[model samples]
Target: MIHHHPDSNMMLEYASGSLNWAHSLVVSAHIQLCPKCAAQMKLLNGIGGTLLAASEPVTAAPTPADSFERLMARIEEDTDASPAAQQVGERQTTAARTRSRKAKRDPIFASVPPVVEKLLSTNPVLPWRRLSKGLKEARLTTGQNRHEVAFHRIAPGSKVAEHDHRGKEITMVLYGSFSDAEGVYSTGDFLVREPGEVHRPTATQNQECLCLSVVEAPVALTGFWGKLINPFLSIRPS
Candidate 1:
């Protein structure tokens, strides 16, 4: 069961169509696994549309610049750069093809879903080092944005430090379960926590867990390690 839906802020952004394509893709993927967030997103969409329609329309003077000219200039620039772009593009293409062949040769990765496979095709492995007891994590920077997402692997029977969040946090369980004060989350469960919420999350016995998490800012850790971890560990923004 998805105990905590995405926090109000993310849903609000989604309703207003403010999410970037890459992050939106992750949210959409989570929505597929979470009915609660799906429902909330739908509601936010309706509410936002209604609010917009309810407001009075205001007319403004059009800008003097010609949009067509701007588009034509951009197209011309792209055309001029196409050769160099193609060279880089070709190199990346060859690399991807080589990787695909390698993946096909690997038996363990053969059964991965095409969507996940396609997504991971270009993703390089992060510097996965141990964070705490039985836990390892790595951060991913989706392009040049301040927002960063992370992938976490928690060994079963392991517990993390009790900590408070600094911003919004969204978590989707891909495998196994993690428990906190609210409830336990199993595979496909989604949890969206608001800022200032505190919890010590621990995995259940028997198996390790895989989770995808996104944070806007960073979480505030409270111990001696927390001071050190705070500098390195990123969390969602408040």
Candidate 2:
């Protein structure tokens, strides 16, 4: 069961489509694993729809003829495109989505949502690089500034270097469990750490832990060794 979740404000932002793309993606994945958040999102969506329906109509809008002309021009451009190439692209996208859906149903990755799976599918063989003896990470390209998303794997009973965030950091446990100074976090837990918050995360003894993490800025290590490697350990976009 999920013991942690995104704060109410974050959830509200996600529901209202106010979150950044990277943050939204992580929240979306968490919603799939969390029934409570999913229900909350549903309620928010309903509220949004109601508000939209009650809103006043625009005084003026683009003419239908202009829209039709633009549509026709787009169709003409598409007609000039290669059908075979389009078919191949469509097939690849469909296959990836199907595979992602199937993966979500599997027990091994039950916490992984379709969106996360689909994004990871783009790079089937992720080259996980070692951050430390027992810690490894694989960065994901999110095309966003001042933030990054990545997957991190920690060996059982291993502890990450103690550090304090320079900005904001969010971590979602995807597999196994880990613990920090605050508390122990299990699968599906959404943890948020802000600038000036410091903690050392250690994986549980029973199994390895995998987490999807997003950080807005590089972290500042607290120890001598951590400080020595902090520059190299900084998370970067792929």
Candidate 3:
């Protein structure tokens, strides 16, 4: 069960399509795993749809005949009407199903939602890079500014470097569990760390922990050793 979740305001922004793509992706993955958040998202979407329907539509100018014709022609061309296109679609679907089955067999990806699984499947053979002795990281490029999305894998009984956020940081536990000064978080927990919040997260002894993290700005490590490595630890926008 998920004890932590994105606040109501964040969920409302997600429902209204106001959040940046990276943040939205994290929230979407969480909603898929958390029934409470999923229900809340549905309620927010309903409210948004109602508000949109009740609002007056603004008058708009008509497009030129040539432009309208070109748009219609493009739409028609995109339709899958040919036998060859149907064959290609079938092959792609089969390949996707094969990948899905393989993912289910892998322990690391067994609990991941379809949203995150699709992203992970894009680079199935890529290896996780070592960030420290017991911590590894894999970056998920979303082509977004400021926000750095990645998977942080912590080995059993290992602690991440102590750090304070410069901006917002949202972390969703994808596997195992971890604890910090604030609290202990298990799978499906959504943790939001605002600016100036400092804590060191350590995975439990029994299993390794994997978390999906989205950071708006690079974190600043605290303490003497952390300060020494702070420059190299800064996670820049990709």
Candidate 4:
């Protein structure tokens, strides 16, 4: 049975596309694994659409002067530019925006299935990243890695060294359980460690543990050896 869940309140926020992207990713992973939340989400969507249909549409905003002309000119210019220039221009404009949009949409949980959102809300701490022995971490989302995601796998009896998150941290267990000095967490459990909090997590030998997690920025390790591995392990936003 699922132990933790995000209630209707949080679920609604997610369904309405209000939650953060990193948070939404955790929810997405959860929906992939859970079923109950999926049903709930469907209900929420129906309710939302009904509400929308019941309301009158708002007036459309007026187009700016020369907007259409400018758009046409830009299209013509794009067609005339050399391939190299077009590629560079595409990277500077379309590519950048596409990535930005995806990253922005990453946390909008409303689009995700219902069951996953509930499981994500199960543990509401930020999320944790494992840096090294006896050390774990929490990441915060500022403005990087718009689409990429990452997670950690801790062997039973294993711990990570100290570190700080560059962005939000959301973790959900795939198997087994783990605990820190704070409390014990088992399979199907979720943890969201907020930014700035630091703690080391250890898993029990009962079974191997898998966690689904996502972050918005890179993580910074504190120790000397850990810092050396930072570049290799550092996660950039998608």
- Expressed as tens digits, the lDDT of each residue in 1-238 for candidate 1 is 5555555776676556566433454566567667787788888878888998999998754321233234334434532335555687776776677567657542423433232333344454555779788888766544335456666888888987788888767777767788989889876666777788988889988878777777777778777878787888654311
Residue 2, model 4, lDDT: 60
Per candidate, the number of residue pairs that clash is: 10, 0, 0, 34
lDDT-better candidate, 2 vs 4: 2
Candidate order by lDDT, decreasing, is 3, 2, 1, 4
lDDT of 3: 0.79
Show where candidate 4 strays beyond 4 Å.
Answer: 7-10, 20-22, 58-144, 220-233
TM-score of 3: 0.81
Cα RMSD, model 1: 8.3
Which lDDT values do the candidates have, in the order given?
A: 0.64, 0.77, 0.79, 0.57
- Over 1-238, each residue of candidate 4 has an lDDT whose tens digit, in order, gives 5666655666787677666555655665565656788788889989999998999998755332133234334444533344566677665676565345446532422333333333333323547765555334444332324634444666667865566776666667655667766677765666666566666667786545556566555556677976687788656553
Residue 14, candidate 2: Cα error in Å is: 0.6
How far does residue 84 in candidate 4 sit from its true spot (Å)?
A: 40
Candidate 1 vs candidate 3: which has greater TM-score?
3
- For each candidate in turn, the TM-score is 0.62, 0.78, 0.81, 0.54
State how far residue 92 of model 2 sits from its true place (Å). Answer: 13
Who wins the lDDT comparison?
3
Superior candidate under lDDT, 1 versus 2: 2
Worst 10 residues of 2 by lDDT: 63-72
